[model samples]
Structures are given as structure tokens and as C-alpha cells.
Target: MKVGIADTTFARYDMASDAIDELKKRVSVDIARYTVPGIKDLPVASKKLIEEEDVDIVMAFGMPGPEDIDKRCADQASNGIINAQLMTNTHIVEVFVHEDEAEEKNLPEVAEGRARSHARNVIKLIKSPKKLIKDAGKGKREGYPDLGSIRR
Candidate 1:
């Protein structure tokens, strides 16, 4: 199977690299990479990867600044991604990290962890979707601490 990675130049970190490393460690698949100027461009890049590159899945990464406009752009980008997924009937896992989500010193770590985690999920999504069902309500999180399920 082929996986597409659509990343933005605006991102503070190279999330695709971490995701690629993680994916390489876990599975063998072809990767189609496309880079654009910013988050708003990810949807089209992802769509092209699927429609033209013939990738089975896509990982879309973006990092918006901590401004209101940035948040709005992210939301719009997310909606476009959803529309692209519907149009292509493919899964485009959106991985967005806000510029202010972590301290400057920790941003890279946060981005890397998130990318790696999502890479695993991508594997599960294509290879064994049942595993996701089994993980339901487990409070699993990518790039951050997993909030374990609450129990009495």
C-alpha cells in the first residue's frame, strides 16, 4: 500500500520526517510526499496524492500560529480535508499542531511524538482497523500523554 504525506512549509517542525521514520520502523509501504506553503494548501496536496499519486492513505500535517486568524484558517483547512476525503473516498489523517501548543523548547518533541503516534494509527487503520475498535474509549492521544480510561 502507498501512503501520502502532505506537509506545510509553515510548520515549525518536520513532522513528516518523524512520521516517515516511525512508519519505516513498523511497516513497508511507498510514500508520496508533497509540500506546500501553508496549512490551507494541505487539502489540495492530499487530494492530489490520492487522486494522482494513487496513495491509499494520507497524513496531512500543519502548524498554525496562536492567532485567531490562524485558528480560523486551521478550521477551514480541516473542513477542506474532510471534503477531500469524501471526494476521494480515502482516509486523510489530519495532524495539526498549534504554534502555542508547547513551549519553544518542546515544540519539536511534541511534534515528533504526535507524528510517530499517528503513524502507528495509520498502520492500524489500513492493516487492522479492528485494533482501533479495540482501543475505543481508551483515551489514546497522539503526541501527548494518553489519558487512560476512567474506571471506578
Candidate 2:
């Protein structure tokens, strides 16, 4: 599978790219990386990359709000593209929220695990069936959901 990864944060992008590279080595996968100026540029950058490369999947990594991410995904969809956003907490306040919850629950380990689990879930969601179809079409496979008649 060919995957395209983009992010606004250089450090996050570097980390995600390294993780993706390790994932590709474990499994059979190809990844392409793109760095964007900011969240506002994501959709445009993604669109350009999609047009230029043959990718089976396009995953965007950033700490943007859910609404912003949704808007970006909608924009990509309008252009017949599939996009997934991976949210990260880069703000100290966000980390404080987690820490507070950990203190309240008296399960710091559990809280940490939850954060890791959520990140994994995001990646899993990006690999869903609908996304697979969209990415496949963007990659080597052309058009999806054929309308031809079934002949038995």
C-alpha cells in the first residue's frame, strides 16, 4: 500500500514519519511525506500531493480542532479524495487536563495507556473499508463501486 503523510508540526511530522517508516518495514507498505506551513494549508497541500502521487491512503497528522479537521476532510472529499486527521495535544494545558484526570482517578498509568490507545485507534480508523476503497482508487486502482450488471 502507498501512503501519504502530512503534518504542520515539524517535530510531530518527523516522529510520525519515523513511526510510519517502522510500520512499513514490519508490513508491506510505502509512504510519502509532506510538510505544510499550517493547518490552513493542509487541504491545498494534500490536494496537490494527491494529484502528483499515486497513493493508496492519505493521512494528515496534526493537533487541529475536530471542526477544522472535519472541514479539511470535507474539502478533500469534494475533490474525490480521502483524508484522515490524527489529533495530538501539543499545548501544555492539554497535558495538564490529562494530568488532572490522572490525579483524580489515581491511575496515571491508565491515563497514559488511554492516550496511546486513542492514537492507535486513529490509525486504525484511517484503514477502514471505505477509506481503503477511496485510497485504492487514488492509487493504482481507478474508479470504485462499479455500476455494471451482474451476470451469473
lDDT of 1 by residue, 81-152 (tens): 999999999999999989898898898888999999999999999999998998899999888899989988
lDDT string for model 2 (38-131, tens) is 5445554555545566554455543332355545643543333223222211110011011222344443343334333333333444455354
Model 1 lDDT-worst window of ten: 101-110
Q: Tell me the RMSD of model 1 versus the true structure.
A: 0.9
Q: Candidate 2 lDDT (Cα, whole model)? A: 0.41
CA RMSD (A), model 2: 13.2
**lDDT of all predictions:** 0.95, 0.41
Best-matching candidate per TM-score: 1
Clashing residue pairs, candidate 2? Answer: none
lDDT of 1 at 5: 100
